[model samples]
Target: MQRSTPRLTRILACAAVPVMLVLAGCSSDSGSDAGKGSGSSSSASQDQQGGQKPATVAPAKYTKLPNPCKSVSTKTIEKLVPATKSKAGTSGKSSDITSRGSCSWNGLDDNGVKGSQYRWFDVSFLRYDSETSLGVSGQKRAENNYAKEISKAQATDGAKNVKTSPAKGVGEAGTAIRYELKKTGEDFSYATIVTRTDNVVITLTYNGTGYAGAKSPDSADLMESAVAAAKEAVASVGVANS
Candidate 1:
């Protein structure tokens, strides 16, 4: 009986070994499949993210703008504003000169008994950059703002006898606006020239009034001066970028 018991015990142990081996094999297969599934999910996430890309737009023609104070020639400034207070011009406040800039000259020429002539000239520049995220080209932006400038000039408060006409040979496109206004109990005449050259827009304003007995400046003369100054300002943009 004792010899038969030993043989039975050894047989049971051998049978248990096979069951343990089967359990280990099942565990190994499950682990491998789970790893493969995780790998596939990660690869798919990366592929989806990589598919999204930013849209492209046309590049801007002008990257930088010329200095507003130096954009015009001394001869032009002297002719426009005689006895000017500052020949170098007074620069307007600008946080970003590359994007926007302005310069102005003003003078009151006292003629003693003949009264005084007050003249003022202002020139401003605006440059646009291509926006890839918004998908807007610089030239398109300039064109849109050019229209807005015209509207703004026409809507001046207290302006009378306002007129608009094409400004020939100034830029790619140009407009001349003339108007009259009453201020400080005096009659004033004004002329504004708005021109767009590529991605940059130039606006020139010339205004004058007679103090005492002097005659108010003519609208036609102001428009001519504004147009000529605008042409020079537009040319400076090309020189700056070059």
Candidate 2:
């Protein structure tokens, strides 16, 4: 009877060991499944927390544009164009185009070729005061109106790859508009329009410069330089009477 009891006890112990191991393995599997499910839920919650679409990153060059109007001067402008054309204002205004010291390269119309060398420049000065209040922010309203008009003109004129950027207003002056136009035949143009108001005097300048890329390589810089110089010339035109 003793020998039978010992053999029976050993058999029972061996069977109970496998049952415990099986239970442990089942528990571990259940825990692992729960952990995986929690991980999935957490990921979904995180995704929901970010409610909007991903933001697009623009190029640094486009985002950070250099002030192309830096260090502009009338003397430097005159150097670019040795010839100056004089025109008098017929409206009995003291602010004639040339009298205002707007110097330019003459006969630009007759220079180079029609589409190759038609680089031209012009500057205008308009005065505004309390009597000419168009908007609360100096000439902001006028500048805005002019920008809109230019946009419309560009659209109607079938200009391609058009980019318009404006700078912040300085003092009581409004803002400046810098634009780039690329034509179908690789023709390019650069322009700027600005309104500066100092004390009661307001000066506005508009310059359109074009270069024949076919005649030279990448004339955008030349056009930019010319327009900036023109702006300087226009700004030099103060109140006619003052």
Candidate 3:
């Protein structure tokens, strides 16, 4: 039984601002909390053993990702984000919704497994401004909304128990609230969520595992670290000012 955070709401009227207009703030962490594992870390060394160039860094065609987890690292993100294969060769993959002050990572399927790989770490970042009372109120509402989501997800069939904690000293933004959802009912999987909010930025993340295999997923801690890294990456980009 995980304790819930207070609800967050927004009050300000969302102004139409360019995504790059605001001076965005970002943060990161590369500590033991990242939970790096053998399979989830920099396997470049291993790639060479198997006779590969460690794969080229793919060209980053920067699309205006509304829900980009700017605070994490590409390396870390690459580990947590659901890969194309994670969907079992499905077409209509999960949908992402993003706005000036809000971002959401939705459409997660419990059965989105790939062979023995039935687990994935989904990640998302929601950026919003607490401009007006309405916006501010609405932004605050998210805290409660997320808390409730974790509560519900924990109580779900596969979720065994849930734990919510304050992600303190992990970034340079607002208070960060993290949720760890463990799997129950013979399913060995878990998920984590990290939310950061201040006057200028309100971001959230959904990182977990639903991959298949008789064993549970590895690298829960590393997944959490990646979320922190993503925050740092976004801060490097700065906010868009309009």
Candidate 4:
């Protein structure tokens, strides 16, 4: 009976060894899976911290601007402003011609005793760049400025009978403002066109006043000329960018 009891204990101990080994194996596998999951999480966190995502912004359409002085053709200038002092157009002072530029033409056409006709024409251009921090696209910035230009022209102090209308087919969008102002003892008819093409804005102003006995210029005619010149100016932007 003592020998039989010893044999039973040995068998029981042998059975416990396999059960303990199975439990240990399961624990090891569970620990390995946990370690793998932690490593994957750490790798994902590192990727996020290392600039894995980048900010995006809309690209600018027009990177450059055309020369303001030569934007309008000679024939157009000659027809608009007779006997222009500077046939090449007088360029305005601009620290950076690439981003902003302006040109002006003014002259008086004398007709002896019939008095003289005075004419003035000017155009300006502004270009914008895309800014990510501002979260504004180049085209959007130009659109805002285009409205501001129209407002500026309409808000001219001492201007009388100011009228604003949309100018179609000139560019992506445009506005024309016509007003009459008495300056230098003469009534001047003014026409201003503000337009935007992609990332650039163009403002063209045409104003004239009859001197002495000459008749004042017609607003419709002045606006027509201004629109034509504005179309030319807007087209120049495409050419410059191309």
lDDT of 1 by residue, 1-113 (tens): 98799767765655667777645443443787868888999999998898766777889999999999999999999999998999999999999999999999999999999
Better model by lDDT: candidate 3 vs candidate 4: 4
**Alpha carbon deviation, residue 85, candidate 2 (Å):** 5.9
**Clashing residue pairs, backbone N/CA/C < 3 A, model 1:** none
lDDT of each: 0.92, 0.41, 0.40, 0.91
Residue pairs that clash (backbone atoms under 3 angstroms), model 4: none
Model 3, 101-187: lDDT tens digits are 232222333454543333343444443333343334434544554455445544555344455455555333333333345454334
After superposition, the stretches of candidate 1 with alpha carbons farther than 4 Å from their true spots are 1-55
For residues 1-242, what per-residue lDDT tens digits would candidate 2 score against the true structure? 98799767666665667777645543442797868888999989988996665544322111111112222343653544333342221122344332222223332333456443444444433332222222233244335444554445345354545454443333244344444454544444544444443322222222334455334323355545544554453344332223
Give one digit per residue, the lDDT tens place, for model 4 in 74-183.
99999999979999999999898878999999999999899999999999999998888877889889988888888999999999999999998899999999999999
Ten residues in a row with the worst lDDT in model 4?
21-30
* Displacement of the residue 153 alpha carbon in candidate 1, Å: 0.7
- Which number leads on lDDT? 1
Best by TM-score: 4
TM-score of each candidate? 0.78, 0.39, 0.40, 0.80
Off by over 4 Å in 2: 1-74, 82-105, 108-116, 132-156, 167-188, 198-219, 237-242
